[model samples]
Target: MNTTITSNGLPVLPQAKGNQNAQAQASQPATEAAPAAKADDSVKLTESARALTAAQGDKAPAIDTKRVEQIRAAIADGSYRVDAGKIADGLISMEGQLNGKP
Candidate 1:
């Protein structure tokens, strides 16, 4: 078997003649002998996947637009306050949650 080096510098061994013929036949246009070959292909979604697909059509998650606008206005007016203690506490809480703590 002749070995070929791909662009990624990996060696690829030649396929068997029988396997090559089978692959070539599969790639060819549908013939009278294989009319149902492509038609038989199927996909089945899991329950969670179906639920996610159904949820995609529902209303989006809740967003506090009023609070967002207030924050934007404060930022534009140079009046937005940054509470370092609150930010630090939030980070610590997040770390605790990540570590499986209540």
Candidate 2:
């Protein structure tokens, strides 16, 4: 009978003395495998941030798609005219708004 100690220092099952292969196989390490656990994810938001996100759902988009389409069509049809006075006034108005002059 052939007997050997396992990795845990416990006596394992005996094999026939003629089987040198069996002794070698038993001495080799046995890989221990465990099942993987599912991963968990979490997110936290401040009260104001949560309210803003919720409110955004009901608000209109910053850029109107319909207006964009109209502008694109006008440009394609050669009807979109650029007014220097209007642009200059708009720039002045923007500057005033930026300076908080209303």
Candidate 3:
């Protein structure tokens, strides 16, 4: 009598096995590393980004002081019409946009 082993019963190829082991190792968290230092670095990077943005300066034209004073006076006299609902809606929309919501 003769017996033969099947190909499916054989072990996985060395390269394929190595790749699988590498992927499993990569999935594990590097918890032993200093997380506090990483958090501090993130904070510093955010501050640097803010400083760069501020250094770019404003792109739009400056508001006229005379017009601003006129508008303030009108509001103080209760003559300027204000839409509270529109302001609220605008603020809500802005908040959603800032939070990355559609």
Query: What are the C-alpha RMSDs, in order, of all predicted structures?
Result: 21.0, 28.0, 23.9
Clashing pairs in 1: none
* Candidate 3 ranges with C-alpha deviation above 4 Å: 1-61
lDDT of 2 by residue, 1-102 (tens): 966645585644433334347567766654432322223434599999888877898683587879977876655554556788999999999999999999
Q: Kindly list the per-residue Cα lDDT of model 3 for residues 20-42, writing each as its tens digit.
A: 35454554433332222222333
In model 1, where is the ten-residue run with the lowest total lDDT? 30-39
Backbone clash tally (model 3): 0
The C-alpha TM-scores of every prediction are: 0.40, 0.34, 0.38
Best by TM-score: 1
**Candidates ranked by TM-score:** 1, 3, 2
Higher-TM-score candidate among 1 and 3?
A: 1
By lDDT rank, best first, the candidates go 2, 1, 3
**Best candidate (score: lDDT):** 2
Candidate 2 matches the true fold with a TM-score of 0.34
Clash count for each candidate, listed in order shown: 0, 0, 0
